[model samples]
Target: MGPSVAKLASHDRVWQSIRQSAAAMVAEEPILASLVHASVLNQLHFEDALNYILAQCLGTAEAPAILLHQSFDELTTAHPDVGAAARADLAAVCERDPACRSPLEALLFFKGYHAIQTYRLAHALLNKGRRPLALHLQNRMALTFGVDINPAARLGRGIMIDHGTGVVIGETAVVEDGVSILQGVTLGGTGKDEGDRHPKIRRGVMIGAGACILGNIEIGARAKIGAGSVVLQNIPPGCTAAGVPARIIGRCANTEPARDMDQGFDDVEA
Candidate 1:
């Protein structure tokens, strides 16, 4: 199978849960019933519903909603992995964010989830040599969500970007699976660079809000970065870095900082 076959088996359970949640929301807030139906219930499949929702959100006069919707549907049809990644991301949000009430809330209302999903779509298109369209989607996403992630950047599944506003990931940045990044974070470059300039974020890393990790550095796996710090050097695995020009304050209290979502720096030395 090329990329069109439905990956229903993998997403079935979550899709059903999301549908139930959406229906519950409609019942609770009767005013939003029509929107909830159009966003989830009316669609034939999960991917179809997602495509329609994002297209309506990012579509503009230059990029009509119908056209954008069809293109996103085609992308998902050609890439079942895209749908799979989106499912993982949705779950990541629901699991990690306390404020996230339901999977339907993550699917319909969260800009962080929306940005990541759209970035996945753009990344898939970029790999197919559709640079122009990929760039266009990235531009629209940045403008709409205040999160700017280049299409060329490589990101893995189960990414949770909490309060995604002002999240800027550079072109060559690489974020591995199960990474939780907060608002105002910047995975960027420090100086004039050519190729592979951005930071390489390892798996299970939790970067706090407004932390800037600049240059071609590697943030080791399961490391936690404190809020508002500037990460200039390579951080070791299972460590916690904080302060301006972040220092290794101490080891992560637990191995899975990303999954734990713990901001308690009580054990770490300032």
Candidate 2:
């Protein structure tokens, strides 16, 4: 098949899966049939469904649902990569999170997935110098999803924020592709420091829940940060760091710590 036809087929497959899931949800819970139809079955495309869902979650008395929906639609249409990243995030969550059953589940119900997609749109707006609107969306995302990621934060695709509540990614933080961060993770800076602060999390890094990486430190690729550790310095590639002021404990056994989702520090030396 031609490239365009293949792309169309892929989209159709995703839409079909989502529709089937929505139909099953309606059959199982007759009371929520209207909600299912409005959020999923009534939509024409993936972006449209996303717009509807985000509007429902983020809309306020001041902003209103239709305005939020239009903004989301415009962002998805303007930057195709936002939609592509949303799909990749869904796949990442499905593969990484044990609770995720299907792409439809991640797309429809995962707050982490929802937060990241909203962040993508806010990031786009920030890049366009629409600071007020971007910050507004960022605030709404934090209020609705319990995840506060700055609009200026640079994040790559295939990110999984498992149990994303209380996750805070600072303005200058840079999260590369294939990074998995658990709840209460803070990629913040030393107090009152200006310019290019916050951590740079490289590819394939798995950060355990409640880990705090501070300053402008570089977390090298495939590194693992243990749960509740406070990272204050650069972590070398393939290393494991843990403790209050996290130290390089030992080497990581797996090359792809993010994909592996291994939080064990059993083999690491004290």
Candidate 3:
């Protein structure tokens, strides 16, 4: 199928799956029937349902739900890639997260997924020079989801952020496609340096939980960073880095560490 048609079909499949899951949820838990209908069954498309849920979660007294919904809808319509990236993220979570049973679970329950989608909208606004609105959304996301990603950061598709709480990505951080970042990870600068201070995480890199990657370093594609490690230097492609002031331990066991989700380190130094 053509690219556009394929994307549409992918969205349709996800919407159908969500509807089926919502129906099953209503059948299993009668108490949640109304909630399921309002959240998923009543919505027309995937983006519509997403907008509704995000608005409900992130909207505040200053920016009400209806207004946030309208803004999100406009952004999604203006830039269709936001929806595409969201779908890819859903697929990534379903594939990588062991707790995720289906795309519906990621859509309805995963705060990480929700945070990324919200960031996508904020990033779009930032690109359009709507800095105030973008910053507003960023603040709301941090307040609501505990995930703080700067609106100016560049994130690619197929990203998986597991247990997204306390995850912070600084401004000018460039996370390439197919990167998997776990909880409590920081992609920040070492000091108060300005202009492209954050790290550039290449494609298919897996960063473990509680790991801190600071400064404007380039983490090569398919490299693995062990949990709780403090990364300070550039890591070459296909290698694994671990421990405080993370050093290159050995080659990555898998070519796509992000997809593998393997955090084990055999040759890590003390």
Pairs clashing within candidate 1: 3-77, 3-78
> Which residue runs does candidate 3 get wrong by more than 4 Å?
1-11, 267-270
Every candidate's lDDT: 0.91, 0.90, 0.91
Instruction: Tell me the tens digit of each residue's lDDT in model 3 across 49-125.
Output: 89999999988888898999999999999999999999999999999999999888888889999999999999999
TM-score of model number 2: 0.94
lDDT (tens digit, per residue) of candidate 2 on 135-203: 999999999999999999999999999979999999999999999999999999999989999999999
Lowest-scoring 10 consecutive residues by lDDT in candidate 3? Answer: 1-10
lDDT of 3: 0.91
lDDT by residue (tens digit), candidate 1, 130-246: 999999999999998889999999999999999999999999999999999999999999999899899999999999999999999999999999999999999999899999979
TM-score of each: 0.94, 0.94, 0.94
**Which scores higher on lDDT, 2 or 3?**
3
